[model samples]
Target chain A: AQRVTQPEKLLSVFKGAPVELKCNYSYSGSPELFWYVQYSRQRLQLLLRHISRESIKGFTADLNKGETSFHLKKPFAQEEDSAMYYCALRFMEYGNKLVFGAGTILRVKS
Target chain B: DAMVIQNPRYQVTQFGKPVTLSCSQTLNHNVMYWYQQKSSQAPKLLFHYYDKDFNNEADTPDNFQSRRPNTSFCFLDIRSPGLGDAAMYLCATSRAGKTYEQYFGPGTRLTVT
Candidate 1:
């Protein structure tokens, strides 16, 4: 079974503080991880994927196979960065469906 | 802009009533998906259409059905909606080879009264 776990439901931080959203996955096969973000009154959008390995909007996530985790990290949190973050695992044994974690609400207060 | 689009941002229907939600995409992607999301929860995949082939999740109920008449359009039909069926229905599209990155539309919020 492929599953994702985001332990924190709410992560509050002050502006300019470092932010890290923890995510862990359970899968038997090689894993493909992605981060999706939904801003207030906006549709969910792709933030980044583990395959790309490129940072987007000062946010980056590294896939850790040994630990079975892919935690999203940002050096500094901005007020505009507050949004709902979801960690998803792409399972291909089926038709390549994404299994998402419950979600984490990151609130960056200014 | 070429993007995924969903109709009726807000829909209210009586319990046991049949409702149809529409999704369209201008990206011309090969795969389109429908998901149900409840408050403060992850989006659950109901089904997806890759071209003309449809795939339904094992846990999906028979009360829900989907259609893809063409490549750019898909529809989700709820035969008899229950109170539990009320949720945000998200429509998404992605290319065949690169199905990892999905483009989601503004979801339709369904209310079952």
Candidate 2:
């Protein structure tokens, strides 16, 4: 079974500071990685997927196959960026059954 | 707007009682999923409906069952709720067959006492 690991349970940063949320996965086959976010009092939503290679809300993650990592990154964090983030891995063959990591709560303070 | 919806955002049920959580979608998606999430824990996949077929995870307790009468509707039934069943249940939908980006509902909070 594929599994995702999010090393940090909580990450705190000041506004305008750079932030990185680390994620690693254990899967032998080609994996499709995604970042999902849940804001306070909001439903969980897709942030970005590695397949698209497009950044959303100034956040981007690069898939490092050798390292088995896909870390969410932003050059400068904003207060609005505070939320819970989850890393997920979708199997190439499985029908949309996602293996999610324990989420990391990102806190951006002024 | 096409979206996933879960009703009764909050539910409270007595221990060993039966409770049902409803989910419906306007997207007509063929895949619907039920996930259980505890505070500070990852959302665990319990089961999903692929078209008219139902698939349950191996570790999922027998207490939990799901019914999808049609493409637009699905229900998660807990036969006998326990204190440990208290958690947020999330419903998600996706297109048929592959790992498509899934859309999630606001989630239903189930509290067992």
Candidate 3:
């Protein structure tokens, strides 16, 4: 079965420190990956997609096909960056349904 | 702004009672989806509507049902609310294509007693 895994349930980093949220997936075919973020009391929003290859809010993710990973990274963590991040895979076979990982809670402490 | 909207930001219901959560989108997307997100967990796909065609997840409980009256509106009906059903219900919309980037609404948090 195709599955997306976010190994870190919670990650804490001091402000100005580099941050990385690890995401891995198991799929037989080409995978379309995305990173979604949800801040406190805010609706979930798309942070970035692998196809877009664009950096948003100082966050970037690179898809490593050989490793089957798409890890989200930021050069310097901001206090406001504290949020829940989810890694999702688009399952093309099932009307392009999004299968999401367990998500990582990133806490950037000041 | 073109956005997805879910009504009743918070809902409380008694056990075995039926409740309906509504969603509307101004984006006019071709697809709408409902997700159940429990605390400290990832959002789970409950069902979706491609235009007017409904698709339910294989593992979705029979107690959950959905309706899309038109392009801009969708509803999630829980037949009998249970304590385990307490969670945040999210509504999202996307255009039909290979590049399916979904836009989500501010979810409705459901509480069952």
Candidate 4:
């Protein structure tokens, strides 16, 4: 069985400040990781995936297999960046199913 | 633009009443999934349909059922609504092959009375 964990339930930061959302996972085999974000009044959408190796909306995450972690980071948080973020892990054997973390609420204060 | 759509943005049901939520997609994707999301929690996968093949999570309760009459439409049926069943039910779609990126609908908020 695979599981994802997000230690922080709420993370508040001021605009223009650096922000980091921590995520850890437990999986025996090779895992695919992703970040999904849900903005106020909007449907959940993909933020970034480790395989792409590209940043989205100034945010990036690197998959650390040894540490079993994939943390999302931004150099400077924007007010509009406030949203709920979820970490997800996809096990190849499970087909299309994804195991997700409880999620963390990112609140960017002006 | 191609997109995933869900109907009845909000639904209110009496306890033990049978309720069904609908989802449709214009993207013509091969996979459609149903998820239940509680307050401040991650979306939990209840089941998914790949073409005509239906797959349910092992831990998912038997009270929940799903139907996909065709490639473009799917339905989630709650056999008997319970207070704990009240949550935001989301519908999502994804293409087959190596790309696992999924498109999600706005979701229907179900309220059990």
- Which is the leading candidate under lDDT? 1
Going through the candidates in order, state the TM-score of chain A alone for each one.
0.97, 0.97, 0.97, 0.97
lDDT (tens digit, per residue) of candidate 2 on B1-113 = 88888999999999999999999999888899999999989999999988899999999999999999999999999999999999999999987754457889999999998
The CA lDDT at A55 in model 2 is: 82
lDDT of 3 by residue, A1-110 (tens): 88899999999999999999999999878889999999998778889999999999999999999999999999999999999999999856755888999899999999
RMSD of 1: 0.9
Per-residue lDDT for A1-110 in model 1, tens only?
67899999999999999999999999978889999999998889999999999999999999999999999999999999999999999976865889989999999998
Clashes of each: 0, 0, 0, 0
lDDT of each: 0.95, 0.93, 0.92, 0.93
TM-score of each: 0.97, 0.95, 0.95, 0.96
- The better candidate by TM-score, 2 or 4, is 4
Point out where model 4 deviates above 4 Å.
none
Candidate 3 stretches with Cα past 4 Å from truth are none
DockQ of structure 1: 0.84
- The candidates, ranked best first by lDDT, are 1, 2, 4, 3
Best by DockQ: 1
DockQ score for candidate 2: 0.75
lDDT by residue for model 3 (B11-30), tens? 99999999999999999899
The CA-based lDDT of model 4 is what?
A: 0.93
**Model 3 chain B worst lDDT run, 10 consecutive residues:** B94-103
Residue B60 in candidate 2, Cα distance off native in Å: 1.0
Q: Candidate 3 docking: what grade?
A: medium
